[model samples]
Every structure is written in C-alpha cells, then in structure tokens.
Target: MRTLILTALLATTTALAATAQDASNTLDRGNWQDAASLGASLDSADGYTIAAKATTLGASVSPDSAKAALLKKAQSYANQAIKLNPNSASAYFELARADGRLAQYTGILESLGLAGEIKKALVKAIDLDPKFDEAYVALGLWNAELAAKGGGASFITGARGDQVIPNFEKAIAIAPTTIAHRLEYANSLLLLNRNSNRSAAIAQLQKAVSLTPVTYWDKQDLAAAQKKLDALR
Candidate 1:
C-alpha cells in the first residue's frame, strides 16, 4: 500500500509538473488571476487547485519559507474542503499531513494546535475511510509523540505506546512500500527503546535504513541510527 501511495505520488507529481508547465506556456495575466480567484472559492472544484498549489509550493520552496506558506494555504483549503464535503476524508488527511509537517518544522509544543487538528481530522478520516493507510500512519505518529511528551490527559498518558505501535504496524501491513511510513514507525520504536526495547529498536532502525532509498535525509537518518546502535553496543 505504501508502495502504491509512493507510486501515485510520483505519478501525480510528474503529471502536475507537466500540467503546470503547459499552463505556463499559454498563461496570460488574466488567465492566471482567473485561475487563482477560482481556486480561492470554497468548493470541490477549487479544493484540488488549492491543494495542488500548496503541494507544488511545498515541494519547491525552502523548508523555512515554503513550509510556512504551504501550511497556511493548506489549512485554509482543508477547512473549505471539509465544509464543502464533510465526508471527504482525503481532505482531512491532507490537512493532517500539512499540520504534521508544521509540527515537525516548528516544535510540537509550538504547533500543538495544528497537531491536535490533525489528530481530530485523522479520527474523522478513519471513521469515514477505514482503509486509509496514511491517516492511520499519521495518527500513530501523533499518538506516539503526544504520549511520549506526556500530553493527552491522564487516562491516555503513556498507554499510547501500546496504541501507537499497533497503528503503525497496521499502516505498514497495509502499505509496505512506503519508506517514510516505516521510518516513522521505526522512530516510534526508537522512542520506545529509550525505555524497554533497545535491541528491538536497533533492529527496526537497521531495517528502516536498509529499506530506504538513497536520499540525503535517508542517508543522514541511517548514519544517525548507526551511531545510536554503536552507542548501544
């Protein structure tokens, strides 16, 4: 499932870039403004346009400036999309991804509201589309991190470790091809290792790195995981 999602994302990215290039070739000032104006409308017709714009900006922009802009745009569109189609779990899922990115870029504490929003939206997405692997993965990460931080009320406390691991596992089972999802699951394992499962954490990190493609960030994470393993050894 992860593989399918990655493939779809890659395909979508390619198609979008090509479409944008085609539009640029013929775009006049009037057309551009018209498109932008249409995009701002809170309707299904506009949701994809807004999401595409945010995704394109997110992919092209520097992490510092680009993400901030993307987060704001994504939030606005996501809200509108939800209002337009209350059952559109994908809209909520997209918002959750955007919020998660913001939380990662800023500290979780700083973006707690966004993270909470993601959590809420994901719950709804799961209710609407139970097979949504991405939502489950995001939820797992959110719950694990929040649990680690000692947030989410008393009954929910550290017990979330039990909850998080299963969600991640389900996500992995559903989408084995998504390296990012597995890496996130491994991260949660590493956190758990800090308490009781050091050996298992090391194993998970090793597998994560082995499965990851050759990207700068992946290499860096692999190196860090190796260092951690060495320290444990």
Candidate 2:
C-alpha cells in the first residue's frame, strides 16, 4: 500500500511539472495569438499572464472604437491570471491598466472610480514586488492627473500632487532606458501645464525621443514624443 501511494504521488508530481514546462514553452512564443491559445487552454497561471500581455498590446494600439474590446480581453486574461495565482503582481498591474484605459473611454464619474481602482492595484503590485517600476509610472500619472484637475477634483479623487514627481523619479531611477516610463513621466509633467514645468517635460520627452525603439508601442510613443517636443518648441 505504501509503495502504491508513493508511485501515485510521483506520477502526479511529474505530470504537473510537465504541464508547467509546456505552459512556459507556449508563453515564450513571440506572437500574441500563440500566447492566447495556450493561456486560454484550461486553468493556468502562465497562460493567463501571457494572454493578458497580448490583450494589453492590443489595447495600447487599438483605436477608441476598438479599444473597449481589447481592454475587455485584457481584463479577462488578467482576472484569470489573478484567479490562478492570487499573488501575481504583474497580473494585478495589467488589470489596473485595463481599468484605467476603460475609464478614459467612459464618463468622468466612472473614470474617477476607475482611478481609485488604479491606485489600489498599483499599491498592491508594489507591495508584492518592490521593484515594480512600471506600477510607479501609473501611480505617478494618477497623482499628476488629479492634481491638474484642481481642488474639487483632488478632493473627489484623493490624489496628491506631492507624490507625483517622486514616484516618476523613482521609476526612472529604477529603469532609466524604459521608453514608456520616460514618456509617462513627461506626460505627467506636461499635465501640470505650468510654464515652469513645461521645460522639464520637454527635457524628459527629448530623452525618450532619442532612445531606440525596443517594442511596437515604443515606436508609436516615440513618434508622439517627437510631435510633442515639436509643439513645445
């Protein structure tokens, strides 16, 4: 009886290991479709993470008319990832990103509520992974946006102007070459729209404009950064 039980446990462990390896292999595929097929293959943490990344990519480039569908897909994948691995900080970040983008498409009241969610999820991500530099960018942008909205909006949104610059600076310190972090920081600075801050925003944009594109979104954002720099001049 003892031998039989040991054999059964070993078999189960081997099978689980194989499954995990397969999932990791599927996730390594460059194409989003490949990741989607594997991630949507029953319940799997890696599957969910890859699927969420693909969906977020879609959301990033999609037009306003199509963004909703992409964000919804991202939300589904992110939720699945969280369900499979509740401690997944990256999953939570993707979920927060989907909500933030969705809020942009919706009304102001709904947007504020989503902003609150963004704040919460970003904090959770940072708590889970102290080196979550990407989360810091989003959180800084949140503070900057609310700060730009004036006293009434600040009161409603519970965002602090004091936190904006530091969070963004931390993200840059953590990942200096990350084009998205630089762009986001510049954007938040421009949101201030004060004559004093415009030069600082321009400086950040110039740095981003000089970097080589590392991803598809990087290409799009670099173009925008150049345009913004031109406008600033």
Candidate 3:
C-alpha cells in the first residue's frame, strides 16, 4: 500500500511538471489562450504567474477594443498568483504591467490613480528580486509617462524625470541583449524629452534592432525599434 501511494505521488508530480512545460512551450509559441488555460488549470503560484504573463501578452496583441478586457484578466491572474505566493516577484511584475497597460485606456484621473499602484507593484517586484531587469524597465516607463503628463501629474505622483534614464540603464546593464529593454529605453527617452535625447534615443533603438528576438513581444518591439530608427535617421 505504501509503495503504491508513493508511485502515484511520483506520477502526479511528473504529470504536473509536464503540464507546466507544455504551458511554457505554448507561451513561447505565442498561443496565449492555450498557455493561459494550461497555467490556470495547474492551480499553483507559478502556474498563475504564467497565466498572468499569457494574458498580458494577449492584451498586447489584441485589438484596442479587446485590450482593456484582457489586461484586466491579466491583473486578476497576477493577483491570484500573489495570493498563493506573496513573495512572487513575477506576479507583482505582471500585475504592474497589466495595471500600467490598462491605464492607457482609462480616463485621465483614473489613469493617474493607477500610476501609484503600478509603481508600488514594480517597486515590490524589484525589492523581491534585485536582478529583475524588466521591473527596472517598467519603472523607467512609469517615470517617463508621468513626466510626459507634465507638472500637475508629476507633482501629484512624485515622479522625477531624472529617474527614467537611470532605471532603463540599470535594466540594460543587467540584461544588455534584451530587445525590449533597449527599445523601451529608447522609447522613454523620446517620450520624456525627444529634442534633447533624440541622438541617444536613436542609438538605443539601433541597438534594439540589432538584437535577436526571443519572444513575441521582443519581435514586436524589435520591428518597431527598426521603424523608429529609420524614421529618426
């Protein structure tokens, strides 16, 4: 009886690992729905994290009309992951991503309201994992967006324009080959102060265009970066 139970437990663990791998493979292929479904079925923190990531990617690729709904779903998944594992850096990161993306579709005041939550989530993610390079990129974008909103928003949020490049630089230092980091850094530079940073922004975009894309988001950003670089030049 003991041997049978142990065998069953081992089989269950193996099945779960295989399912998790399948979810990851689906995500890598950009089959967001399958990836999310598989992830959510696992009922684990890591699984919910994958669901959040897949849903977030779905939001990004969806039409503008569908984006907000998917982003909200992503937020829900991320929150679920956090509940299961409070120390989950990826969960916090995905929550921040979903919130920040959703902000773009919301009204001005509501968007401003979300800024604080997004920043807090990103900060928590970074605190949990100091080497989380994407969190730094997201933090940079947060500052850039607030700075773009001008004095009233910046004052309300305590967002300093000076922090944008520094955060992006930190991400780049940590993961230099990441296409999104270079592209987003260039994007933030242009968004905050295009006139003064145009040359630097162009350099970053050039770097982004030269990097190999490893995921759907990376490919999308790489293409955009190339287009932007061409237009700038």
Per-model TM values vs. the true structure = 0.63, 0.83, 0.95
Between the candidate structures 1 and 2, which one is better when assessed by TM-score? 2
In candidate 3, which residue ranges exceed 4 Å CA deviation? Answer: 1-7
Worst 10 contiguous positions by lDDT, candidate 1: 25-34
**Model 2 CA deviation exceeding 4 Å by range:** 1-34
- Best model number under TM-score: 3
Residue 118's lDDT within candidate 1 is 70
Residue 8, candidate 2: how far off, in angstroms?
A: 14
Error of 3 at 15 (Å): 2.9
Q: How does candidate 1 fare on TM-score?
A: 0.63
TM-score of candidate 2 against the unseen true structure: 0.83
Order of models, best lDDT first: 3, 2, 1
Q: Per-prediction RMSD in angstroms?
A: 10.0, 3.8, 1.4
Instruction: Kindly list the per-residue Cα lDDT of model 3 for residues 1-233, writing each as its tens digit.
Output: 99999999999999998998899889988899999999999998889999999998888888999999999999999999999999999999999999999999999999999999999999999999999999999999999999999999999998889999899989989999999899889889999888999999999988888899987767888888999999999
In model 1, where do residues sit more than 4 Å from their true spots?
Answer: 1-61, 105-110, 151-159, 210-233
- How do the residues 1-233 of candidate 2 rate in per-residue lDDT, one tens digit apiece? 99999999999878756765564455444345555666666466666766776666666666778888877887888888888898999888888888877877888788887888888888888999888998999889889888897887789879988888999988989988888888888889878775878889889998999898765566777888888889988
For model 3, name the residue pairs that clash. Answer: none
Candidate 3 Cα deviation (angstroms), residue 134: 0.7
